[model samples]
Target: MRIDLTSVFVDDQAKALDFYTDVLGFEKKNDVPVGDARWLTVVSPEAPEGPELLLEPSGHPAVGPYKEALVADGIPAAAFSVDDVHAEYERLRAHGVRFTQPPIDAGSVTTAVLDDTCGNLIQIMRVA
Candidate 1:
């Protein structure tokens, strides 16, 4: 089966959508309601109509524990494969994004870590 969807635990759905779609250059794939929260998803412009990143609702009873666990353990941000780690990192940094770790070479790939400001460390990777 083809991998088409993934979820990112977010504190606020609308804000997350704005950041991911407006800031990170992603396009909205879904914006329908699914019970209490809406089914919002975003896709990379480079991979339009490809895999989607779901902005999952946090503060929910079931996912609250997991989200808290990840945040407490300092392992929250989700990663995304990038075409150019340095360029993307620079562009994001220019947009006032805080990066805990700068771009560094990791043999086969170059990687960088940025703070999503939403209780996570988002990693961007690119093949070297």
Candidate 2:
């Protein structure tokens, strides 16, 4: 079997949508109202029919602590593949994206980490 979808817990769905779409350049795939939250998802514009990243609401009590711990430890919640890590880093930085870690060559790949502003750290990487 193949992967279908993955998720990133977000503090605010609206802000997450703006960042993931307007900033990160992902395209909205689904947005269905589910009680107090929405079943929102985004997909890479380059791969519209591929795996979708769910912009999950962090309403559950456990999510806050989990996200905090991850951030405290400098761990990324999700990683996105890019054509050039350094280029993407510069572009994002120009758009006011605050990166926790600058792009660094990690043997076979280069990566950088940025705060998503919705309470998560996201990584962008490229094969070196």
Candidate that would win on lDDT: 2
Residues 1-128, model 2: lDDT tens digits: 99889999999999999999999999999999999999999999898999999999998999999999999999999999999999999999999999999999989999999999999999999986
91, model 1: CA deviation in Å? 0.9
Best-matching candidate per TM-score: 2
What is candidate 1's local distance difference test score?
Answer: 0.82
Clashes of 2: 0
| TM-score of model number 1 | 0.87
What is candidate 1's CA lDDT for residue 15? Answer: 85
Clashing pairs in 1: none
Model 2 per-residue lDDT at 62: 95
